[model samples]
Target chain A: MTTRTVAASKSGKLLNKLFPYLLLAPAFILVIVLNYIPIGESVLRSLYDWRGGSRATFVGLANFKELFQDMAFHISMKNMIKLLVFQLVVILTVPLLAAEYIFRLKNHPVLQNAFRVLFVLPMVVPRIVTVLIWQFIYDGDVGLLNGILKGLGLVSLARPWLDDPRLALYAIMFVGFPWVSGVATLIYLAGLENVESTVWDSCELDGARGLRRVFAIDIPLIFAQLRTMAVLTVIEVIGGYMFVDILVLTGGGPGWATMVPGLNLYENAFKFSRMGYACAMGLTLSLIALFITLLNMSLFGKKVDE
Target chain B: MRIRREDLIRLLVLGFLAVLTIAPFVITLFISFKTEAQFIRNPFGLSLPLHWSNYATAWAEVRKYLFNSIFACSIACVGALTTATLAAYAFARFSFWLDKFLFYVLMFLIMLPPIMSLVPRFLMVKRLGLLNTYGGLILPFMSGSQVTAMFILRSFFSGINESIFDAAQLDGASEGQILVRIVLPLSAPVLWTLAIMNIMTSWNNILWPLITLSSRELYPVTVGLMFFQGQYAIQRGPLMAGYIISSIPLVLLFMFASKSFIRGLSSGAVKM
Candidate 1:
């Protein structure tokens, strides 16, 4: 009886040690197969001249060499940079302003909640639908912008907003105009809410109110949220649904005006079947994203720590 | 009592911004109800005799896409939540060898942007014989959503009072039972928030399904809407109606669970 009880306790201890591994196995296995392994394959395949087949010939650095000289790739990179700049500026400022406006109405909790709900409501609309609606708005004829322009008799200014090479990228950027109706605003509002009441009291003692208080206290307090938004914005510009938007709207259109690297990579891999070259492009893009993410982290992260 | 001038100004600014934000949807609603002739006469204004038939035309085209989207997103959300919850509970409740290392390994993936691996992932799916199928769409979405769900759930689980878990353990409950009974019921709010967010994401996703499924019959609403727009390019009324039709599921979801939805969005920002 004594020997059996000891053996049972030993087995129970062993099971306790193994239980956590069993629990984590499903998640770890899925990510490894679906995410990490593919990432590894991307790196390896970048060096091989492989199509969508079993056979692959080693072609070290050739794909990367070709990528550097590709004019379309250069154009896409330049356009992506332009977009990154535009998005960074707009995302940082516009959402902050919108959140600030909502944060000021905190005393009226009902109105505050109403505004919060209203701001986040548009997010329910699918992104593709949003893009398509903008496509209609940018239509040369019978479009909302043009219709309004014609109504106001500004006919000269009402050309095809998306068809123009000079305007297409900008027009795409302008889709979510007054861009406060996103989760970024809510995140900022949440950050503002966490600011201690004593800070507000001190700001009031200093006679800092309105925009003055915002500059003095609120912005400083929400620096971490700003950093988070900035990092996410960078990652998004580099690799987000901008490609889908461009694909559906312009297809890189009238002379590669709105071409971005993600769309360029997609076209290479799927459309043109330049699999190796696409892999190389993917590596370069990921490296660029990583570099920027690290840079943003070090820059703002240190500030926040200090 | 007279309202303060500053408060009045603030209210006006908020109202104006709100109107500008919602203007597109409001215009789409108006356009969806107008006849082509009425639209040509006045594109921006609401016209008489609202053509409800436009919805019928849209519904016929949109229903298949809606069904596919609902089917795939539902599976992905449920799958993600299950795997992520188990993993989160493990990480929170137990400390084993490689615990921190494995957690960080999973966390590292959050930085690897999905676009970077898009080509290889496509090839991988093709190799697995999942191309042109719902598995191709649902599996990646489940994997992709795990990081955020795990991150959120793990933190929430860690915050629960340890005494409850201890009590359950002392009663001779297995770890699985403790998880299903104690942890899950306690974390319902977070799970609900994560589900809504995951569904919203998978529903909006376009690029993956666009590439994977060449079959028109299997297209999700986002991809299908693109084709629908092309087919009905000239028919503005029905096209606008289709866009509105596609938005109904999520909008209804928002109406019923607005608080959870809002919490999901805000907590989603805490990913970093």
Candidate 2:
């Protein structure tokens, strides 16, 4: 009770902490088992030329070489790049413009919430429902588009939208444009709301017209939202293009017109049972997506945390 | 504040958006009430004889899948919320050697595109005898999504003042007691936000469940919709009806929680 008691008294003034690490133990274990473990397994599998077999030869990088040789794989790469560009334009432009309008009208809560709910409905809707709904809209014989075209005296141009290889990818992209607009619009709404009302008032007082005020005050603040949306849209398109393969009724048909990376990866893994090759495809697509995301972050995103 | 010609243009643009947004659901609704014969005959037109019975039929067909989805969604929500909240509390309140490194690891996990690990996850789940179980279906998504919940909760918990923890400590509160009594009560809003977001994700996730759950009884509504499409390849009635039933919960959720959900997603995105 001499020195030991004195030391305990001094240290006891500090708060005792235990079991803090215990709180994190479960999450740490689960991620290791689920995510990192699979990543490791895929790496190991990538070294083998196994086709779901008991016996296989280890051919490191052979799968990558074969993937490069496949013409469809090359096209998938090109199409992915094209999609990244197209998405950047469509998703970025509409939200930047729409956020300005929504910001100007922020005083009206009812109208604001009404439009927001409507737009974001598609974002929340199950992907298959959207796909099926659009599939009906794009149908050939009795679709909404053809019926409207015929009614509007444009029957000459009413044609099968998904059957043509040249137009098939665009038709698929059409479905994406609206499905994603809701999230961007919401992001814009949030960004615009964050801009001080006084700033807009000042711009207005300085003879800034509607569009001019938007450019002068609104875009800069909302640019962060725009960059975030652009990266998300690119990643989404790359990951979500597989759903297009399901809905467009083409299954990347008319000679692989709408064959995006996800669909290609799916076919390779499941149908072809080339686990190694499929892993290569997945790794490649992920790297490209990562590169684009990093590029956008550096170019447009602010260094500060949100 | 005056209603200029430009104001009218803005309103018109919003009008166009309204139509574009709601048109698909409207189309799906109309076709859902149509007869199969009418649907196949004119997929785009009004039903020759309106047939609302298709909904009952479709529901009976996929009710098992719907039930499974509800069960799995609940499991994931509970699992994710508990684990994320616990870890977030530790990271927010404590000073530890590995805290920063672990936090950065969680961030890295969030950035990963899930499809990259799909093949390996499938193989692992299969080998674990969880191929068609509810545990298999919900566990992977829960594990994958915890990064987000941890991030959100960590941000929220760190905002609480340190004095509260000190006071609780002076009141003879143990770490477990402080967590249960103080931290949880103060973090309700963030918890609700995480719940709504996770519920939506659980409801809408397709690709992972599609690959893992092979038994029809184990499929979620998102994957179950694919079956509707497969069975009704030429008919739109059941297909449209399926869409209507499957999407009602989400539509209602959006209608009710639109503001909170939008704020959550935007805030989450901006942070990332």
Candidate 3:
């Protein structure tokens, strides 16, 4: 085997071993320097009080202390919990049902494929634009919601959906009603497809079809997908601000009713020039997301390869 | 020609949901053609005159921002595609003690939201004198795509028949040649999928571009549209028009590539 390459030396062996690293280096460097390194720096930056282009002054967790004391932050946290609960409930139910409904249309490939395409096609529209379109639909006077209510002769129920602080958060959450994401649906379908044919056949043979088969077999097998959606939504809600920011009527609202931690962190960083404070919130948010991610992996994520 | 009542019921329910899904875009399209006065008079109704001037006006307004977006996002997608392809190939084809460790590290980064490091990233880029330049905006976002794209592409690479590469190697072809000649050609679908995704993420990015590129000229359409809509808050017509301009390309792309695009996002749970 070594005959044709008998002249191989120390450098050749080293180069052979190092070749993979060389190929991997650019991405590794980019990720470390641009993505991962900043994470460490953020932790360091959060401990300092730097603002308005001033020199950094070490503050030793004062930012977090201040964050805890701030009542606005408190409201933001409550709002986030509220949104998270709503998001979790919707995510677990709607997407799974939609996927199941489409999956049951097994005999009709045309219909199944069409519904799948329709469900996912909206993804091409930039999320921000969707938020904006919903903003139009939620408009108090001339908006589609009010127009529909008026058309249905339930005009009394059409009062300023996004304008009322009590209604703003719910209205934002309602934007793309049914909340059955194409991604979640696809993941679920994939999981279902992985169910062994023999297992499914046996279940059918035993008359364990329909909802019973779904609850007993499909749901358990797809528990990993459900857990993934739960973790992803929580992280997304904590990081996202587009919806709240576009609540044009209630811009963090008549009373900070719709304010979320992500939006709050953003406002602090740029709008309030509280860079240090925002960094602290960033770290906290990261830790929360990290904790949830770990919880998911431990609880329901796929078993690790040895 | 006998239709089962159950099948009919399923068809009706499915069709309704499909309509509900497609309606928002349809409404946006019709409303986009309306003049401000017409919208005020009949907000939810069809655009009677079918005024097309709004598109022209919206184009004139957001063209600079659109150019900046295309420039920055495309460059970032290309950068991401290149780096992600290389790293994914390494992870897929080579084995070392550090391979699993490094792969997990990339996944860990993927899991961490950018909110985690938003400020420090800004400062680091600023310190490097990359602030406000297209590269500054492009680089971090490019790196952001590495984890997901690497995961996706690595899985794709690993699925390829390895004997083909072995044959190439036996002919004295280098790893680079094998990757280009054998791997790259086979990787078109995944590559296109990742490229489109990278482009979408880079284009849809707002918070990072907002923080990093404070200069008005360098703003992507998302940031520009945010500010523009904020400026024209009450001008619902013009605002809708701008939203139309921004959405049409993606909507068209989806109409064409919806199958593969949805497949890519669907097959993976960790979509951006």
Candidate 1 per-residue C-alpha lDDT over A1-306 given as tens digits, one digit per residue, 9 for 90 to 100: 999999999998898898999989999889998999999999999999988688888999999999999999999999999999998998899889888878787556777788888888888888888889888889897688988888799999999988999999999888878888886898898888777888888888889988777887888988878887787788888985587788888988768999999999988998898888898999898899888877876766563112
lDDT for B17 (candidate 3): 72
Calculate the i-RMS of every candidate, to one decimal place.
Answer: 2.5, 2.6, 2.8
Q: lDDT ranking from best to worst?
A: 1, 3, 2
Best by DockQ: 1
The runs of at least 3 residues in candidate 1 whose Cα sits more than 4 Å from the true structure, single-residue gaps closed, are A302-306, B264-271
Tens-digit per-residue lDDT, B161-202, candidate 2: 989999999999988898889998887656766777788777
| Candidate number that wins on lDDT, 1 or 3 | 1
lDDT of each: 0.86, 0.75, 0.79
Candidate 2: clashing pairs of residues: none
How much is the lDDT of residue A95 in candidate 1? 87
DockQ, each predicted model:
0.63, 0.55, 0.56
Cα lDDT, model 3, residue A171: 86
lDDT tens digits, residue span B40-118, model 3: 7877668688888877878888889888888888788888888889998999999976999988888887678877888
The residue pairs that clash in candidate 1, if any, are none
lDDT of 3 by residue, A63-122 (tens): 999999989889988888888888889888877887877777766878888888788777
* Candidate 1 vs candidate 3, DockQ winner: 1
Q: Where in model 3 is the C-alpha error above 4 Å?
A: A1-10, A52-54, A197-199, A241-249, A301-306, B231-235, B265-272
lDDT of 3 at B205: 77
Sort order, DockQ high to low: 1, 3, 2
